[model samples]
Target chain A: MTITITAFERSPDGGQGLARDTRVRWALEEVGQPYEVRLVSFTAMKEPAHLALHPFGQIPTFEEGDLALFETGAIVFHIAQRHAGLLPDDANARARAITWMFAALSTVEPPILELGSARFLESDKSWSAQRMPLVKDRVRDRLTQLSARLGDADWLDGPFSAGDLMMVSVLLRLKASGLLDEYPNLSAYVARGEARPAYKRAFEAQLAVNKPPAG
Target chain B: MTITITAFERSPDGGQGLARDTRVRWALEEVGQPYEVRLVSFTAMKEPAHLALHPFGQIPTFEEGDLALFETGAIVFHIAQRHAGLLPDDANARARAITWMFAALSTVEPPILELGSARFLESDKSWSAQRMPLVKDRVRDRLTQLSARLGDADWLDGPFSAGDLMMVSVLLRLKASGLLDEYPNLSAYVARGEARPAYKRAFEAQLAVNKPPAG
Candidate 1:
């Protein structure tokens, strides 16, 4: 069955590969699975058709034959579970890796997202400047713990897995904020993830869509 | 192998079942699995010993024999995968159910958590009053979509899978805020989850720990 997934017609990030479709693409690349992308405009995303697939009205919904799934974590995990390279063979190791995946999304990403909402959604608000530090500090607290745990390690656990993939993707949001730079190991960790051949391919794929056409 | 999971020695919620451990316990109960709970103090959660088991330094870490896991979503998922009842037998249905679990934690819960942090962490800030509407609106937006999707359905997808388990848990946080009441269907949805025998057992177990002794 041919795997089909969705992406933003024009990403809000303008091809930074920060959009979640990049994560799904990266997962597919890591597993050496060929897939197709269906672009959905922001308006189309909220339409009944897209909402049927993703109640949240987000991109990167996966479809293979009768299976339809959403949420980048779930999409990535589904891909990882069916494929060999994204998860470990050992059951215990695989469970730990999945734990990291949840930690990345549930524990770590929430604060980072709060920071984004402060910067973008509420940029014009009266309290934006004053409240920025509190939001950033919240993110810093999480990063501090993550950095400590990641001390002198290559990937989160052992070899690269979906956990690292999700964590790196979550941390990448903080690159512009410079909070990730404060933790050198985490910065290096993100760099290593970016250095992966699969990541590069995925990045380029999303970049191609967002790149401006020549006049 | 006997399964052991950790919980907060004294839950900050006073045993309302808002703690992530409740979610894990509920999953175990749904699958008819008996598990042991080990309590961890807040200070110990941050210490290296507990951090080794849970890098993020939160409660609800699962240990069985030599294998240990953290993150409630992952722990619940592990139980659901190994045991019956929490997940569907159909591969596609199972994937969709897991998708709801991710949706619960990643999409719905993030905004709710922000509202929590705003109310609890930033309550003293000058901007709390002004900024709260924005945070609340963010949650309302997600719930509106969720309520729409859930219209007249007992569960998000099908017969009381982990998807409903997670979505219900996430929605329960909003009960105190009164936001959940705005959507009658969602409020009913959560009530339905609470009405389940497994959920009741899980709730009572946590309540027992947090309940004060009678005079």
Candidate 2:
């Protein structure tokens, strides 16, 4: 069955590879899967058809034959489960890897997301400036723990599994903010993920779509 | 191997069952697995010993034999994968079920968590009153989309699986806020989940631990 996934017609990030479709694309690339992309405009995403694929009406819904799935974490996990390169052979290690994936989305990403809202959504509010430090500090709290656990390790666990993939993608959002620089190991960790061949391919693929027309 | 999980020594919710451990316990109950609970104080949770099991220093963490894991989504998922009851037999259904689990933790819960922070952490801020509506609206937006997709269905997908288990748990946080009541079907959906024998057992067990001591 041909695997099909959705991407934003024009990403809000303007091809910075922070949009979640890039995460799914990176997973497919890591697994050596040749999948098709169906780009959805902002308006089309909220339409009935897209909503059926994703109740949240967001981009990056995965479809393979009769199976339709949404949520980047699930899409990446599905790709990892179906292919070998993304998970470990050992049962215990695989479970641990899956744990980190949840940690990334549930524990780590939420504060970072708050930071995003502070910067973009609430920037014009009267309290935005006052609230910015609190938001960033919450993010730093998680990163502090994460950086301590990570210490000098390359990937989160052993090899670069789906956990690392998800974590790196989540951390990439903090790159432009310079918050990641505070934890040198985490900054290098994200760099290691970017250095992967599969990630490079995935980044280029999405960039091609979202890049502006040259003069 | 005996399955052991961790919980808060004294839950902040005072045994209302909003803690993530209840989600893990509920999953274990659904699958007919008896597990032991290890209560950890807030200080211990951030210490080295407990942090070894959970990098994020939050509960509940799962341990069985040599395998140990954290992140409630992953813990519930691990239980679901090992046991039969919480997941569907069909491959596609299982994938969709997993998708709901991710949706619960990633998409749905973040805004709810934001509401939590706004209520508890920033309640003293100058903008707390002004910001309350914005925070609630963000949560309402996600619930509106979820309610529309759910319509009259008892669950998000076909049968009650881990997806419903998780979505219900996430929505349970909104009960006090009255946001859930705005969507009757969603309110009813969470009610159905709470009404489950497994959920009831899980709730009662936690209540026993965190319930106030009798005079």
Candidate 3:
């Protein structure tokens, strides 16, 4: 079955690959799966059609035959579970890798997202400046623990799995914030993820769509 | 192998079942798995020993023999995959179920958590009052879409899978805010979840630990 996934016709990040479609693309690339992208404009995303697929009205919904799935974590996990490259063969190791995926999304990403909201959504608010540090510090606390646990390791657990993929993607959001730089190991970790051939391919794919046409 | 999980020594919610451990316990109960709980103090949660099991230093953590896992989504998923009751048998349906789990933790819960942080962590800030409406509106936006999707359905997808288990758990946090009541179907959905025998058992178990003793 041909897999069809959605992406932003013009990403808010302007081809930075921070938009969630990049995560789904990266997972497909890692697994060497050939898929098609159906780009949706921001307005179209909120329409009844898109909302039917993703109740959240977000990009990056996955469809293969009768199966329709949304949420990047689920999409990535679906790709990973069916493919060989993204998960370990050992049951325990696979479970741990999945744990990292949850940790990346649930525990780590929430504060980073809060920081983002402060910078973007609440930028004009009176409390934006005052609340920024508290938000960043919460992110820093999580990164500090993550950095300590990483402790000079390359990937989060064993060889690169969906966990590392998800974690690296989550940390990439902090790249502009410079908070990721505070932890050198994590910075290097992100760099290593970026260095992956699959990641490069995925980044280029999303970049091609969101990049502006040359003058 | 005995399945053991960790919980807060004294839950901040005072056993309201808002803690992530309650989600895990509910999953276990659905699967008819008897597990042991080890309560950890806040200090210990941040310490090295506990951090070894869970890099994020929050519970609940699942341990069985040599395998250990954290992040409630992953733990519940691990139980669902190994056990019979919490997931559907069909592959596509199962994927959709997992998608709901991801939706609960990633998309739905982030704003709820932000509302929590604003209320608890930033309560003293000058902008707390001003900023709260914005946070609550964000949550309402999600709930509005979610309520629309749910319509008259009893669950997000089908018959009481892990997705409903998780979505209900995430929505349970909104009960105190009364945001859930704004969406009658969502309120009823949570009521259905709480009414489950498994959920009831899980709630009481956590309540037993965190409930204050009678004089």
TM-score of each: 0.99, 0.99, 0.99
True contacts kept of each: 0.93, 0.89, 0.96
TM-score of chain A of each: 0.99, 0.99, 0.99
| Alpha-carbon RMSD, each predicted model | 0.8, 0.7, 0.8
Model 1 bad stretches (over 4 Å): none
DockQ of 2: 0.92
Candidate 3 residue-wise lDDT at B112: 97
Query: Against the native chain B, what TM-score does each candidate's chain B reach?
Result: 0.99, 0.99, 0.99
lDDT against the true structure, per candidate, is 0.95, 0.95, 0.94
Q: Give the deviation of candidate 1 from the true structure as CA RMSD.
A: 0.8
Displacement of residue B129 (Cα, Å) in model 3 is: 0.8
Question: Per-residue CA lDDT of candidate 2, range A141-186, in tens?
Answer: 9999999999999999999999999999999999989999999999
Docking level for model 1: high
lDDT of 1 by residue, A1-215 (tens): 99999999999999998999999999999999999999999999999999999999999899999899999999999999999999999999999999999999999999999999999999999898988988999999999999999998999999999999999999999999989889999999999999999999999999999999979
TM-score of 2: 0.99
Identify the superior model by lDDT, candidate 2 or candidate 3.
2
Report the TM-score of candidate 2, chain A only: 0.99
